[model samples]
Target: MRQDTEGLLVRLESDKDGILSIDRYGFIQGINPVMAAMLGYGASELEDKPVRLLLPDMDEDLQGDEWRAFFDSRIERHHDHLLEFVSAEGSLIRLDVQMFTGDGLQGGMTLLCRDMTLHLGAQESVFRQREQLSAIYTHATDAILLVDRRGYIENSNPVASELLGLSHRRDGPFFIDDVLRIKNHHDAWVYPFSQALIQERPVVVTDDIQLVLPGRSAIPVSVTASPVRDRSNRITGCVIVLRTTSESRRVSTRLSWHESHDPLTQLANRRQIENEIFRAIDHAHIDDTTHIFLYIDLHNFSVINETCGHGAGDELLRQLGRMLQEEMVNQDVVARIGNDEFAILLWDRQPEAVMDEAERILQRITAFSIPWRNRRLKVGASIGVELINADSTSEIDVLLSAGAACAAAKAAGRNKINYPSPERDSPSRASLSQWTVRISEALDENRFVVYCQPIVPVKAQRDTQHYEVLVRMVDPAGNIISPGKFIPVAETSGLIDDIDRWVFERLFTTLEALPSEVRTGYSFSVNLSGGTISDEKFRDYVVNRFAGSSLEPGLIQFEITETAAVSHFESALAFINALKAYGCAFSLDDFGSGQSSFNYLKQLPVDYLKIDGSFVRRMEVGEVEYSMVSTINHLAHIMGLATIAECVENQSQMALLEEIGVDYVQGFLISTPVPLNTLF
Candidate 1:
């Protein structure tokens, strides 16, 4: 029995197939003679080494989650696949691998492998015996050639002759390698057929392979070669296949050009420019490189396109593309992304340089005009320059910053170059600066007037009512300007406190003129700003002015924004307490709009929590909004505060708010804000 077991062991070790044992950590524990010989290493040298010494990219795969789970669960697994190994000579060797989980035997695995060259020879032998392949070879679109072992062509198809421009050559005079001219992308000669026949091995040549004719353009094609052998395993000849790639190559070239170039302007397109931006971002991340992205708007280009003909507009766009190309340096890229919208990309360019270039473009555009029929069409340019760096948040953030800066330039009357300051300049901020001067002038001339909107109770049984006082401005031409237009400016420029005082004084005078029954029947609400809340002088001035008037605090409700209140926590707390002591009520306007949490609601002495218009206006159409409104209402009720829904535009929104147990609603549905004189 011992002699029989030893003989069996000897036969197993002597087998041509490879076998190896791997520890739980993928170390080579034991290697059979065949595996050691195949790996070009002695048995003692391979043992106790990492398996990755042969298959470097395979170590992670062997210890992958799925592989680990197989072993931990004690689930036996069998898989047959091809594994590639980098041999000592730095050439890839593919083997048919049969791997299995070792049934948790010491928490390890087993691998069996065989070189696929022998299996391929057998498959080719079977393929050669199939008589049907003869017809297939004759009808195939690719060129096929049969050459004998002595390097003489035996048979050829029509395509094989045509591929090499040898359609007129007889079979006896034309040798396959002599008649064909092949080169690689680098224009170096490549003899895949000759080399394959000499080496008695297969070869595949790709990547810009070309076939040259005597007096025509070189055709792009790929060459594949395989050695043919007889059943006795002797090299007989070779089969060379040629595949023309011109059709696919032509299609690919056209598609690639179209993707990266704008058809209209013949410049880089949006996708291509975006790729440039991505590269710039990657460069910035690596070495803190800075770049500039300029958003350009051809001011009133649309009007020119509409007034003049489309042909005239096309001429102007083409001129603009050419003009920009000539104006920019070699490293700069200009793109037309949409109608009348263009972008300029500059890497590592200074802000001052960008500003100078933008100014030159603007000056040139302002001076240059195109003749359209009998009239000359001219337009200005507004460019917004944003300095991009690693500190500029994200790619989209910087892009939006540039867009806002461009919009601000346009808003500031156009024909200008605007670089975003460290502090961003939004369109609203531009309007704020413009209105600041106008607001000061209006205050000097008393152009500010008061408007009021009625707030109605959601429940019909409740009869309490209040009117919110809103402010408007009258221009020199006597046009009534909406509060929405100037209030943002007032708050931003520290004019809200003055405006608040102006509204307070006007209300007192108006109340005194009205009959007592008018004041007794209804109360009034007024919106206040954070500037007024934190101003001690404004608070004292209001106290003294109101104490002297016939206006009782009970007839007034002061409204403050949630964001403003949170910003001036200490001041807001003191102001609310002082106002409440005077028999007045306070409401937190636009309550849920800011990041301030409802957890602070217990500390704020507010009589009302006004839900923001964004959630209230869309509550009927959005389920999440309805649920949100319901939640805010429930929380407000728990805190013993009434809720008012803003921007209740239609009956559906009204009905939803009422269903949610809201106390009141103030929006256009109930009344549009109008001059106080209209009320009288």
Candidate 2:
């Protein structure tokens, strides 16, 4: 028995686990090297030492004889316990300990210990991750649902219950499709979760998705489903997230409406009318249909705006907009194009029928009145009807023709419909059609020529010669058509910008071809159209031209009409500033022509202000005209801008402009617009 006990002790010393033995007196009788190392001591140091040194809080009942008896009672039986000990590093450590009782002969207790520190740390980390997931799942905003492999609802967030109208008293787990029904825009049922589960990937439904509710109206929603996976990388179920999108859709719809309609009257605005006109022109071309375009100009309306305030005018316009809509058929279109101007598109109508409709609308507008603050407000409309057919060149042409007819009606007398007389208007229409072709041909064949009229200094001797550049087209018959006849046609046909670019390039090329000495002593001003000012491509072209040219930027000036600059104020300002940075100058040509000329003058960074020829022409005849020119010149000087008087046809006009402190004068008297070569 002693030999057997010695063999067992030797084997225990070689064991990987820690081992220790205590005597009846509770002293460490022996300890294996593993157990001594675990306690941060040598085997010899712990031998014969009290076990209470390792376990400081040993129970009083577990001391001396009691401890021996307690351990001996479970002899030949296995027992386990968790014990805590302090290492030499002053750190607390846990151990899984197995104990065995020795017989009376041995009279001691033996313990086997295994370190459990790493296992406990792993378990704690897992517990913390679970808690974080629980919090996120509970507090999510979008409706979230978890499903099983069979598409059964396994779990759901609070939002899911409320959003899907789920009942708290539901008996058991239900299928996802049984609880929620989703449809697409075409009224076809959509099953995003099923798709995700089958395809083992994410599925999204965003195109006009609607969630149908029991006994309630359907609501718009966006849904996404992602497949959930198990440890083996096999799809187990799906996670569905749904978000309501009705409010967002509503906002988008409202923005689209505002883009195409006027806010005050909820009627189509000018841009929408232009689109409709384009469509009408297309229809006319395809079907040889004749449409009527009515340009309605309200006369005597400004009287209400002046006497009763703009509020009354606004109310009147709103009423007029609604009345126009009421008088039109479903296929007909009406739009508000200007302050007191409205346009109506009569689709696919005979000429006689369109004429009759125009007459009726004219009478209705003339008789229309509204009561406002103890007074009845009345206004009249002049309606001009133009025919839209396969012969129509463009929307602008149709609009201009209608506008011209309206002006003629106003000139004839207001409150009537001016039907274009076939006999009188056909030649004008034919001329317009011919001019469209002619302009294109001219641009292609280089039939356009540049002319220059001198702009002479009024007060100072000229250091550099100044000229206002002009353009003329030589027709196939060798006839020079005045700008008054073709410029309007060019403008309406959308060829004005082309003409502008042609003039600029031609002038530049011609001047660059001139003798350097001759060109360096002169400055040229080129006119820019409204369309050109608004065109970004044209702006880039100008910049590139200037960058590539050898001409001096200071000698090249751009002239934009007052109305054109004011109409496209932002584009004009940007264009002007861009060129001005390159050392070029700008002139607000035909100044005092727009109603808000002075208001915009302060904002426009111009080097020159050209008084409108109408004002300059009559400055000699009337005080009002004379004051207009003088006031313009005075204001221009106040803003540090030079003033040029246009249409100085006589010496008297030049003398008057000089008296007004004008800096320059250009007209027939200065020099009839001569050929570019003649200027040398």
Choose the strongest candidate by TM-score: 2
| lDDT of each candidate versus the true structure | 0.73, 0.79
Per-residue lDDT for 415 in model 2?
A: 83
RMSD, candidate 1, Å: 27.6
Off by over 4 Å in 1: 1-349, 352-432, 462-464
- TM-score against truth, every candidate: 0.41, 0.50
**Residue range 592-630, candidate 2, lDDT tens digits:** 876554656788898999999999899888999999999
Model 1 alpha-carbon miss at residue 170, Å:
90
lDDT of 2: 0.79
lDDT of 1 by residue, 237-354 (tens): 8888888787774454345556776766767777777677776777778889778888787765644654565688787887777777777764577888655768888768665676
Pairs of colliding residues, candidate 2 = none
